[model samples]
Every structure is written in C-alpha cells, then in structure tokens.
Target chain A: MIRFDNISKRYPEGRDALQGVSFHLPAGAMAFLTGHSGAGKSTLLKLIALLERATRGQLFLDGENLTRTGKRKVPLVRRKIGMIFQNYRLLFDRTVFDNVALPLVIAGHRHQDIARRVRAALDKVGLLDKERALPITLSGGEQQRVGIARAVVNKPPLLLADEPTGNLDPELSRDIMRLFEEFNRVGVTVLIASHDLDLIARMGHPQLRLHQGRLLNPEVLAPPQ
Target chain B: MRPPAALRVYFLRHVQVALNSLGRLYRAPLASLMTAAVIGIALALPSGLYILTDNLQRLGSQWDGGANLSLFLRHDVSIEQAEALREKLAQWPEIERLRLITPQEALAEFRQLSGFGDTLDILDENPLPAVLALKPAAEATRPEAAAALKQRLQALPQVELAQLDLQWVKRFNALVDIVQRAIWILSALLALAVLLITGNTIRLEIQNRREEIEITKLIGATGAFIRRPFLYSGLWYGFGGALLAALLLALAFVQLNAPVRELAGLYESSFRLHLLEPGQWLLLLLCGALLGLVGAWIAVSRHLATIEPG
Candidate 1:
C-alpha cells in the first residue's frame, strides 16, 4: 500500500523531478507507472523506496510516514519492499542461488530457511537448474529472471521494478510481465515503472500516467475520493 | 529475544563472518601473505627487543651485587677476633648470611686472581686484612636501607671499613630502564605503521568492491552487515601477521641460542637466555590482533559512511 500526498522532489540543481504527484494505491493492487523519459517514474519509485527524500509533501507506505522516517530506519522499511533494476544489479561474482538468497541472508534467516525459500523462488522463475551458475554465465533474460527471483525470494509485501524488461525482446518481456502477474495474484502490491506504453496497455492493469513530472490523471486511481 | 540469546546469535554470526573472511584471504594467498608478512616484521622487531631487554635485566638481577655488604676488618684484629666478629654480625636481622675470609685466605685468592703470585709470595707481611662478606636482608635492595646497614657494620669495634658494592648494579638498572623506555617508543611507532598499513589495505578493498557494496545496500543490507566481512578480514590479517611474527622470533631465538650459550661460557657467566613465557607470547599475539582490528575499524568507519545506496 502506498499513498503520495502532493509529493514534489526537487533536485539540488533546482530541477523538479516530480511535481505535486498525488495518488493512493490500496493493498493488493498491481499498476504500471507509465511515463516518457525523465517523466519522474524512477524518481517516484525512488521516493517510495526511501532512496531519495521528497523535497516537499509526504509519502506513506503501509501506514508508515516514509517522508519522516529517518535514514536509520530506511533499511527496515526497505526490507518490506523488493526492488529490481533494469540492469538486474545482480553481483556478477555470485551464483544464481546466492543472488536469490541475498535478501533472506540480510534478514538473518537461518541456512535451512534461506535455502528452501531461495530454491522455491528460483523454481518459480524457472531458474532452479542454473542455481549454481554465476550471473555472468546466464543470458540476458535469464539474468533478469534471477533478479526477479531475488526480489520475490523474501516474499516482500510490495515489489517495485524499474524498467524490468527494458533490455529484453518482446517475447521475453512478455514472459517477465507474466512472472510479475503471477506474484500479484498471490497479493503482493506491484508497481512497475516503464515507458513501454503499448506492452503495458495490453496487460489491462490500472495505469497511473505521468507527464512532465506531474501525475496526469490522479482522479482515476485515487481510492474513494 | 532475551539479551543473552540475542548476543549469542550475534557472536555466532560474527564467528561465521570471521571464518568466511579467512577463507576469502586463503583464496588469495600471495597477496594476503605479503600483507601479513609486512605486519609480521613490524611486530617482530619490538617483541624481540622486549625479550632481549627482559633477559638482560633478569641476568643483572640474579647476581645482584647491591645485596652484598663488604666489611673489612682492622689490621690489628686477629683471625680469631675476626671469626668472633662474624659470629656477632650474623646474629643481626639485617644480615642474612656472612662468610669470614681470613687475611691468609684473602692473600692466596689475590695471588691466584691478581696474576702476581710470585711477587706476593716474596712480601714479608701480607697486606690484605680479614673481611666478612655479608648478604643483607631483602630490604637492603633499597639503597638507603643498604647504606644505613653498611654504616652500622662500620661502627663495629673490629671493623675498619664497610660499604655496599652496588655501584655497577645501580648503573645496570638505569641502563635497563632506558632500554625499556626506548622499546616502548619503538613499539608505539611500529604500531602506528601497522595501523596505517591495514587502513590503506581496507580502503583499497572497499574501493574495489564499490559496485558490490552499492548493490548490497540497495537490497536492504544494513551498514553492520556490510561492515562485518571487512572487519573480520582485517582481523584475519592481524591474526596471521601475529602468528608469523611469533614464528620468526622463535626461529631467531633457536639460531642464537647456541651462540649465546657459548659466549656466556667464555665470560664464565652462568646466564642463559630464557625462552618466552606463555603469557608474554599471548600478549604479543593479542597486541598484533588488536592493532589489526583498530586499523580496519578506522578505515571502515571513515569510508563506509560515504557509500550510500542511491
């Protein structure tokens, strides 16, 4: 669950990355943040992840005021939100299993729990057989799948993917989108930031569009007025 | 969780990380050994100097001339009177033991030692007077008390002169003190060198792993988690260096042992270099490990804060 109340993030160089964007997505909702380049999609995701602070207004995620949450509590907040980047961001030296096990390890889960959860997540992403292989050995789509498995391994209540399929072909992109849909069916709130409007529109999920750093149509998605 | 339970888990994780760090080092043996070897040499110098000074001081203290009081009898005192005087002096609490040397016995020892045996035999009258060699109580190690006791011996009717033969002992004690101070200064400087070495190494490590660190932070790894491996690796470096230093010192001691013994024999001295005690060795190891930890900590605290996930 995320609620942004007129959040505006201004960079130090006097550029407004996001301008007064207001929206609320309730629990278990899946949506795409559709926008062009520099339309503040990544910035919005970053603000929600507490990677960047809003220059003005507030952000609330799962009942906690993220705008006011200090840096010390950022890690605890982030533990609840799984994140994926376009580049996969997987450690090249780590094996597939290790990348998937990263979140559980950070949470201090014991060996047995981490192993079991990591294997199940890998199985869901169809990467179980490549668990021992390093990220460098994997294909682009397979590496991105490893990133997906890692994001979901911890079973975080919320998932944020920034350009998850930006590097994949159309078919692989569809497969990646299907993986996200499977996660959403089990009730994890998912927000994806992407510029692939045609592909996202075919999925028929609710869309929150941004133009020139402004939420184009907050009225369509704001919960109950 | 209860505090004890939490602490136990925390320590277990730390131990795991420590071993993992060591494994990582083992994966790069040459680099790790080279770093540790430098640290080892730095540590070994001070440890060797400390042991050397310690042995010298021990040797000087064993035959402590400061504990001895020499009482020279008057020339008029007969051997019987000198024997009576020794008995009288031996009864005092200050005198632990006293041995009387009659003039005839003294003359014979002088003739043998002074290398003028034939010349001394031609003299009509032997010049050496009867003497009593007294070992004072343990309290006489204090120079003032020894001097007071010497004055008491000189006041005796049969005694012509009494003095403590501890001038060389005092000089040796001062020399040992100076050596100890110098060792401390050298140790301090070398400790700084070790700290800088470890700090620079950790800094370079953090730089090489910048991308890994950024990814870890992005995936919600806390600062403590990111720091654990580095700190443990630093400790391993220290631990390895300390072991190497101990090994080096032991080898040196073995090589020097026979020669030292031979030299002592030539001087007719009963002194031999004592091997390092267990406690001293433990302390050296601890010092090396602690220096490594501190160096790593300093580097991490300074650099890790600058690396934040974006």
Candidate 2:
C-alpha cells in the first residue's frame, strides 16, 4: 500500500530529516517503524500521509504517486489513510462520540450510517459506553481508544499511528497495539512509528529500523504473532 | 418525497454548521453581543444619515413646482389696466397659471397675516399694490429661464418689481445634493469598517480554535470543511449586527417622527418621517451578510493554510 523510492527530506534550515530512504510495504501488511528520537520515523510516516513532501524521490500510496499530488488533492488522498496521534488529539470540547464521528462526517456519510459505524468502531475499541463522555473526562487509555475508534471509523484501507502509545502505561500500550493488530488482521495495512523497542518486539511484526535520517539495514522480517 | 440524499446532506451540513456557530455565540453571549453591537453602531450611522438625506431630498422635490413669480403693479396702474396686463401675460407660453390679486384683497391678506389690521385701517389709501402672481411652466422653471422671466416681467410698462425666490430653492436642492454625497461617502467607509471588524473577529476565533483546525485538517478534513463553521460565525455576527442596526434605526425614527411631524405641522405641511421600505431592509440585511461572508473567507484562507499537522 506504501512505496518510497529513495525519499529524502531536508528542512529549509539545512537539517536533514530523512535521506536515501526506500521501502515498500505490500498491501495488507503490518509493520513497525523503530528508531530513537529524531530518527525520521515520524518524517517517513508524514511522507506517506502527504503531511510533508519528500525533498527528493517519489512516494506512492495505494499505487498512486503522492509526490506529484497538488495541494488541493491532498485531502482526498489523505481520506484513504486513517491517522492516529500520540496525544489522541481529540477535540476536548466535544464528546467522545463526536470525536470518533469526525472522519465519517468529513466523508459526508449519511447520519444513520455514521451513527451505526461510529458505534461499531467504538465497540471495537471497547469505548462504547464512553461515546457520550468528553475526552477530558476519559482516562489516558480510554482517550487513546477513542482516537483509535476515530481513526478506523471510516475504515480506511491504510492506518498510520505516530507514537500513539507514547503517553500510555505499558499495559495500555499493549492494548493499543493489540487494537492495531486486530485492524491489520482484517486486511488493513498498518504502519506504526514508535521508540519503544521492547513493546515492538512482543508484537512480532516486521520492523523498519532507522538511524540518523537513514534506514539501518534490511532487518529480518517477523511474522505476525 | 424529499430532496435527493446528497442535496439533503449538503443542506443539512450547512444548517448544522450555521447552528453550531450560533450555539457558540450563545455560549459566550457577552463577547458576541459586544462585537455585534459594535458592528450595529457602525452600520446604523451611515444608514441613519442616508435615510435623513432621502427625506430631505423628498421635501426638496416637493417645492420644485413652487418656482412662481410675483409681479407688483405700478401705484397709478388702474385695476382695469392691471387686469389687461394679467390677461395678456396669461396668454404667454412661459406662464403656466396667472392670477390677478386686487389691491383690496392684497391689503386684507397682508393685514390678516401681518397682524397689522388696526394700523392698516388708519391709512386713507391702501399702501399695498395690485400683484399678478405667475406660475412658470415646467420648462421655464430652470434658474436661467426663471431669471429671464423675472427680468421680462419687471420691465413691463405697468409693473414696478418682479420677484422669483428660485435662488434659495436652488440652494436648498444643492445642499441636499451635497448631503446625499456625504452619506454615500460615509456608507462606503462604514462598510469597510464592518469588513474589518468581522475579519478581526474571525481572526481571533481562528486563533482560539487553532488546535481544532489542525486536528480536523490532520484527519482529512478539507479546507472548505474546516472553513464552514467560521464562515457561519461571520454570517451570524453580520446578520445580528444588521438586526441591531435596524432596531437602532427604528428607535431613532420613533423618537424623531413625532417632533418632525409637529415641526412640519408648524409650517402647515403634512410631511412625516419616511421608514425604510421592505426592499431597503432586505438590501441592508444582504449587505451585512455579504460582508460577513467575505470577511470570514479572507480570514480563513489566510490563516488556515498556515496551520498544518506540525
């Protein structure tokens, strides 16, 4: 679902975020992106999400070239991927239901369809009862589950999470990772960027390791556990 | 039995956004009212001035046909001779209507109006001369034409003086013209003020909702989708401001209408304050809504691009 041909990104201030990065994750595969802080994990995920463009080389998602996509077309392209953030990034003023309903709303889904899908997604994340609760009132793990529901509500074929478990306890982190595994098992391509090497080892997903803006090596691919 | 699903959805989205914006305003009543009131005052000043000038223009046009001339007959000119002159002048194409006011009738009118009846009764001979009042034709009502008519009438063999008070009438019309132009200039400035006020308000709103905007964008919301609520908020501000301005104008009208009617009554005129017609009210509302929409559009386009998922 995602392919990068030697993608390189450089900041305007002459800082290199990613250099000579090339990878291809076939459709329906789940992978973990592991690196220390500032190891270009977020940058690579950003490239896939079209949040930022590669300074050099072409990037493709679902067989479409993202490098040549115009700014106006970015939203439509982004709709095909569900993105989760470490902070959950829920609108605190809104209820958990509203937060999860956002993607479907953006897609202009019917009201009944949105309600049905939102409940199902929330149910999948075990946040069914907290749908009407505000994100501020939810615990850290619960808030992350709300974020997960939101990301998968529209059922995008590809999901990208950036340090999604960064602020969670180890148990909560595993629960979040398990939710991702569940989505991946249903044929949704998933790529998660994290600095937690120990948690990643337990998931047993293939690893894409980076160091100082460059991929380290073609590491051994781990079968899904 | 209803609209297409897509059309309904589109319309419902707009209604949803509009109501959401209104709800936000409702939640913060004080700040919203303040901003809207400021806009209202700005809009009311120009609109009020415009209505005043419009009324003045109406009053001025009513006097357009009063461009008449009064010809004073010579002291020795007999009633028969004055009557002959009046008949002859009445035949002239320049004169629309002519009336011969006899000396006795003139004296009686002057005594009654001037409150000098006792003093006038002491005089052996009537001091007032016979006058022939002349109503100029429409074509002769122009300043130069009226002046020429006056000069011709004054040069008559049996006439001593001819007066046409067209100058002051012309001056009043010119003054009204100047005031109308001033109102136009004021309206333009106030419209700019409205735009700036709404733009600034939306700018502040965008800043406060920066995180929401960024999060929405990050989750595949288009620029237009994110802009919808802000635009609706602007619309509400402008629409509310217009309503307040209309109320203010109505209050002004009510306060001034009675005194104005009394003043007109003192002059034996039946003129009353004119209220805005339905079309004019619609225009005011439309102007407010359009300005609000544009201001919001500008603020959203400028600030939204600067905000990304970063």
DockQ of each: 0.66, 0.67
Candidate 1, chain B, TM-score (2 decimals): 0.81
> Candidate 2 lDDT, tens digit per residue, A110-222?
88999999999999999899888999999999998999899999989999999999999999999999999999999999999998889999878888999999888744432
Using TM-score as the measure, which candidate wins? Answer: 1
What's model 2's lDDT at B49? 90
Query: What would the TM-score be for candidate 2 when compared with the true structure?
Result: 0.85
Model 2, C-alpha of B106: deviation from truth (Å):
8.2
TM-score for each of the candidates: 0.90, 0.85
Worst 10 residues of 2 chain A by lDDT: A216-225
Task: Please tell me which predicted candidate would have the highest DockQ against the true structure.
Answer: 2
**TM-scores for chain A, candidates in order?**
0.98, 0.96
lDDT of 1 by residue, B14-133 (tens): 888888889988998999999999999999999999889988866765674556888898999998888888888778987788899988899989988999998987899999999899
* Lowest lDDT block of 10, candidate 2 chain B: B57-66
lDDT of 2 by residue, B1-310 (tens): 6569888998998898899999999999999999999989988998899898889766754554468789989999999999999889979998889899999999989988999889888899998899998788867776788898898988989999998988776777678778888888988888888888999999999999999998888888998899999999999999899999999999999999999999999988878889799999999888888888888888888887888987
